[model samples]
Each structure stands twice: as C-alpha cells, then as structure tokens.
Target: MAIVSTSTSAFYERARAGMKDLRSQAETLQAQLGSGQKLTRSSDDPVAAARLRTLSRLESLSTIDKTNANRANADLTLADSAMSNMSNSIIRAQELATQAASTTLTHSQRAGIAEELAQIHDDLYALANSRDSSGHALFGGNNTGNAYTLDAGGNAQYIGSNTSAELPIGDGQSVTRSMTGRQLFNFTDANGNDTDVMATIKTLAAALTSGTADPAAAANDALGSLKTGLDTLSTAQTVVGTRLAWLDVVSERRTSLSELRSTEEADLGGTDIASTVAQLQQTLTVLEASQASFTKLSGLSLFDNLR
Candidate 1:
C-alpha cells in the first residue's frame, strides 16, 4: 500500500488561505453596508456599473433640458406681457383716432391728439426693442442689438433675424425662444400695402400736426390700418399663449421622465439593505468559525498531542 503524506506547513498554509478568503468576503460585505451601495468598484458588477453610467449621463442631460425650459418660459412670459402693453397702447391710439376723425374737434384739439399718438408710437417702438431676461433684445430673434432701429427718415426698420433661436428642452424636442419684431408688429394693411404699427401711427401723427389738407381724412384712413394692427397683435398674443401652454405640457412630461429615471437608478444601483445585512451577518459568522477552527488546528501538532 502506498501512503500519501501531507506536511504540517502545507496543512497550515491551506487553512490560512481558506480563512483569509472568508475574511476578505466579510470585509467586502462590511464595506457594502458602510457605503450603502452594492458595488465598491465597477469590477464588482460590470453590467450594473455600465447601466449606472448610462443613467447618470441621462440625468445630466435632463438637468440641462430643465434649465433650457426655464429660460424659454421666462423669455416667453416677458414677450406676452410686452404684447399686452402694446395692445393697450394700440387701443388708446384707436380712441384718439376716433376723436380726431370727428369734424367737431378744433385744429388745436387734433394737434394734441397727434402729440399723444406720437408718444404712443415712441412707447411702441421701445416695447418692440425691449430686452429679455438675458439683456438681449426680446423681439430681435437671434440678434444682440435692438429689434427695430430708426432710419435717417425717422422710420422704424426691423434689422433682426427673420426667425427666433430655438432652445432644446428634452427628448428631441425644442422651442422657439421668442418672436421677431417684424412678426409681432408688421402686417399687411387693409389696402394690401405692407406697413408696421409704428409707421402707421407715425404717418397719422405727422399728417395731423403738419397742417395737412385733410387731417380728419388721414385720421379716418389710419383707423383701418390700426384695426388691422390690433388684430395682428391679438393673433401674436394667442401664439405666445399657445407656446406657453405647450411648455407647460413639456414640463409635466419632463417631470414624469425625471421621476422614472430616479426610480430606475434606485432599482439598478441601490443596495438591498435588509438582505445585505443578513448576508454580512452570515459571512461574519462563517469567518469567525473558520478562524477559530484554524487556530485550533494550528495548535494541534505531534508535540502538543503527545503532551
């Protein structure tokens, strides 16, 4: 019969390796409990870690979308308020025009109305050149300067871009930040001639105060253009309101998506506290048992047994 022999040193080495492995497992569980995460390193769970990275990137993009949505909301709100003021100014101008069209009014009275109309025109010009929250022209599209500039003849000229800049909100969606001055203030008059609200008011004021042959006729003629301009303003207001409502819907969707991502992130990377605690207890118990067994086995040798 052939006898297989194991050395004492080899036996102790084997026992140490086993106990060391158990200790390492216990430490890992303890670390997981302390960190409140299942993974201390990507190597611990490569697939889960990769998914976490993707979720984190998505979360960052969502944050950017939220910021853009907020900015768009602010810019649109400013536009709506400015339009409201312009509408009021236009209504007041209409009333003045109605009074001026009456033959009962004296030349001085008509001149006073023209002065008021000039002031309203100035106000409208300023409103058209209003600045946004970022200090850029609110109705200037992508232009950094004033939306409407005064020409050599004192006429308001739109120098802004034809289209507004678009801001990305999220999920492949975008929104136009604002409308250009030309979009809001300029329109085709009843005579099928192209003119803007400010220019119509300017021409009417000039005729009334500049000793024209028929001031009342000019005032009556401006009534039709003023009505058309008011209608254009109303339509523009409605468009802005619609955009604001759309933003609200997109905001709700973004919130829902954000919540979903949070839930997914928790499910993917969050530790299972109770199960982890139980596992840690079991591993510690096994490690302690192994250590005790190794100590006992190491102390046992031929000399100790003989003694």
Candidate 2:
C-alpha cells in the first residue's frame, strides 16, 4: 500500500510538470504568431538575432543617406531656379544695352536705360544671396551667411567660400549640394578679364549715365560682357543639371539597397506561421488530456471504499 501511494504521488507530480511545460510552449507559440516574429529575444536565436542587428544598422544608415540626398537635391533645385531668373535678367539687360547703343537715343534715354540696368543688378545680387530651406545661403558654400554682399561702393562682393559644399549620399559617395558665388556670377570674359556680372552691369550703367563718352560704344562693350554673363550662366546650369541626374542615380541605388536589407531581415526574423500554429495546437491538446487524466486519477482513492 505504501509503495502504491508513493507511485501515485510521483505520477501526479510528473503529470503536473508536463502540463506546465506544455502551457509554457503554447504561450511561446502564441506570442510568435501574434508578433509574426520568430526571435523576440537574443536567446531565442542567437545567430539570427545577430544578423538582424546588422541589418538594422544598415537600414538606419540608408535612411540617413536618403535624407541627405533629398536635402542636396532640394538645394540644387533652388540654385537652378535662381540661375534661370539670372539668365532672364541678363537677357533683358542685353535688350536694354542694344537700345542704348542706338545712335538715335538721347542722353536722357540712355540714362534711363542705365537706371533699369541698376535695378537688374540689384535683383541679381539678391538672387545670388538667396537662402535655402534651412535658411543658409544657397550659394554660400558651407557658410550660413549671405553668399554675396554689397560693398560700400555698391559693388556686389562674393563673401562665400571658394569651394561649394558636398553631402554624402552613399558609402564613400558624395554629391555637391551647393554652389559658390564665385563659380556662378564671377567668370572671366572673352578678354580674359575677371568680371562679376553685377560689377559689369554697374560699370556699364555708370558709363551709360556719365554722358562723357560715346553712349553707343559703351553700350556695345556692355553688350559683349552681357553675352559672357549668359555663357557663364549656361555653364552653371549644365553643371547643376548633371548633378541632379547623379542624385537620381544615387537615390535609385539607395532604394535597391533598402529593399535588399528588408528581405534579409524578413528571412532572418519572420515566423513560420503554419509550423507555429501546428505546435500550439499540439500543446493545447496534450495539456487538456493531461488535466482530464489527472482529475480521474485524483478521484480514485483506495480509502474511499473503506469510508
């Protein structure tokens, strides 16, 4: 009788422990199904967890790269718009100079044209010092201040850096994000003279208004300088357009890399739904059977008949 009682107690303890284990297994499977992830903790799968960490780091870097690319693209877009306006202003200056060069125009008429040229110069100066979305000078070249400033003599001066700013868009890859005033507005003319567009316009305006020399000759010289200004603008536009195209290419590559990282992460961390569900079902069934058997065994006592 003693041996039988000891055996029964051992059976009950073993059955209870088994049910507890089954319950724990069921919970694990349920959590995985709900979360749709196989490895919640590092202990769940060490190798897979390590791989996920790496993929996450790469994904973070990709996000940063994308942001930088977008910012660079936006700054370049602003620069392009400003350059377009500058081109239009230069063309208008050409027309005004042509009119002034006519022997038919009077002194007052020539002075009036110079007055309009001065306004265009002011507008170009403002445009050159235009700000980006972040309020930094668009052509400042790493400077947060204005790209061009007016001197005491009213000449437009380049206050920005010599080299334009660059942004990193990928691993070991960078793109020019800004232009310098020196590159866009300060260019050499056909005569190899270092002339700023605004300075040239100012000089021409003063010459036209001076009334001391032949207005036609002054107008002709200004027209040549304006042509040089147009060429310089065209070159800058080409450079900006090329950079924009390069940004597109880099963006495409970033998207592709992002997709690859996502795939790798899914393969490493995602759950096997079908297999997990089957395991949960099996655990539930075994737990229920064990509970029913334990209940029946607990009620069957040798002392019950004696009572």
Candidate 3:
C-alpha cells in the first residue's frame, strides 16, 4: 500500500506512541500489584498456577472436614459423659438396694434405704433426659428434639435412634458424634437389668412402709437386684471409657492433620515476599527509564533551532 501523507498519519503515529507508553505503564503497575507473585490461575503461570489451584482446593476441603470433625467430637464427648453419669447413678442405687436387703438392718432402716433408692431412680430419669449445647438431647442422637419420654406404664422409653450422628473428617474418614438415650442408658444392659432392680426395691420399700408378710424376702430380693445392676453398670462404664479413648485418638490425629494442612496451604497460597518485592522494584525502574526516553524522543524537533 502507498503511504498517505496527511494529518491521519500524524495522528496515527501519535496514537501509536501513546499506546506503546500506556502499555508499558500498565505492565509496570500490574507487576507492582502482583509484587512479582503470580495469581493462582493456569493463565498466569500455567504449571505453577495449576498446581497451586489444586492445593488450594484440597486445603479448602480439609478446612470443612475439620469443622465437621469438631462437631462430631463435641457430640461424642457429651454421650460419653451422659453414659458415665448413668453408670454412677445406677451403681449408687444398687448399693442402697444391697443395704436394704441386709437382714441385719431393721424394718425402719430398710425404709430409709428405699427412700434413697427412689431418689437415685429419679436422678437416672433426669440423666436419661439430658440436653447438650444448643439445647439438643445429648444422648438422643440425631433426633435431639426430645430425649426420653414415658410410656403409659411410666417406664422410660427411648425416643432416639441407635446409630449416632456422624461427621466427615476428610480422607474418607468420619466420626459419630452422639448416641441416643436408648443406646447409652436404656439398652438391654441398662433397662433390662434395671427392671428387676425396680421390682426388688419397690417390693422391699412397700413391705417396709406397710406391714408385710415377712421382712426378709423383700430386703433380700432388693439385694439381688443390686448385685445384678452392679455387673451391668461395670459393663456400661467400660463402653463409655472405650469410646472416650477412641475420641482422644481421633482428636490428636485431627490436631496433627490440621497443622499439616495449614503448612500445605501456606505453600500453595502464601506470597513469597522477597521475590515479589525484587520483581516489583525492577519493573518500576524499567518503567521510569522508558517514560524518560519516550518523553525526550517525542519532544525532539528538527526545526526548533532554526525557528
């Protein structure tokens, strides 16, 4: 194409010169903002950015998993504590029943023991209905709206499920946070054994409160209930202890995993201050020199001295 000599050419030249300088300034500013560090996108630094993006996603997932782990941990601890309390309360009731069963004790003394046993029963009922943080039933599992309700016969009925709520802890690992009242306090061990205990204690108490055929049967029966309950209580306590131990191991692993993930996140997302600063300074120097040279070249005119 033949070159056109008109104001259009001059304007084109001026525009091109301005655009070149503008482009240079933009690059300098971008370097300053980035501080020589690249963004986590394949377009920025394909290989590094891709790797960083993957790492960042993994870290995000791990963070969510940690939160889930924490929730599960809280629920499990609550269940463990509730189970422990039930074990203690039942054991105490058993002791009182044993005392009442003793032949050496007078009828009046047996009555006192029955009264104490009654209080223990009441306490057990309360513990069965225990609530956790946020007012959910601690031992009610996922159906935390209510813990224990009474049947028509006034016996405790578990209103929860067997499997406790679980939370994801990352890497395909999950943990259960809680067990319902039925699972922890009112299973075959807690409920089945307790039935006989109540029978024995009630019979003894009634006999002592009112004149009965014989003082011996009522008291002895109550003592039998006590012995059975103790055995059951021991088993229940061991379950709680085992669960707590598992939770502790998981908790330690959680802590270590968290620290490891944090370090990985730093590697993926954190800026390298020294390298970034140096790159920024170098770009600034080049931009300044370019601008000065462009200013001098653009200002030069062949006709200035002659005019």
Q: Pick the candidate with the highest lDDT.
A: 1
Q: Give the TM-score of candidate 1.
A: 0.90
Candidate 1 residue runs with Cα over 4 Å from true position: 1-7, 301-307
Q: Candidate 1 residues 1-307, lDDT tens each?
A: 1222457667778988987888888888888778777788999889989998998899899899999999999999999999999999999999999999998888899899999999999999999999998999999999999999999988889999989999999989999988889888889987788998999999999998987898889999999999999999999899989999999999998889889988887777777888888988998898888888878876866666677
Instruction: Evaluate model 2: give its lDDT.
Output: 0.89
Give the TM-scores of the predictions, in the order they appear.
0.90, 0.91, 0.72
Judged by whole-model lDDT over C-alpha atoms, candidate 1 comes out at: 0.90
Candidates ranked by TM-score: 2, 1, 3
| Order of the predicted models by lDDT, top scorer first | 1, 2, 3
Q: Write the per-residue lDDT of candidate 2 for residues 1-307, one digit (tens) a residue.
A: 7999899889888988888998898998999999999887999889889989999998898889899899999999999999999999999999998998899998899899999999999999999989987899998898899988888999988888888778899798999987788888777776898987888889889988899568798889888888888888889898998999999988988888888988888788987899889999988998999899888988887788899
Candidate 3 lDDT tens digits, 212-265: 666666666656556665565556556656755765786687668768766755
* lDDT of candidates 1 onward, in order: 0.90, 0.89, 0.63
Question: Which ranges in model 2 have alpha carbons more than 4 Å from their true place?
Answer: 297-307
**Each candidate's root-mean-square deviation in Å?**
2.6, 2.5, 4.9
Residue pairs with backbone atoms closer than 3 Å in model 1 (clashes) = none
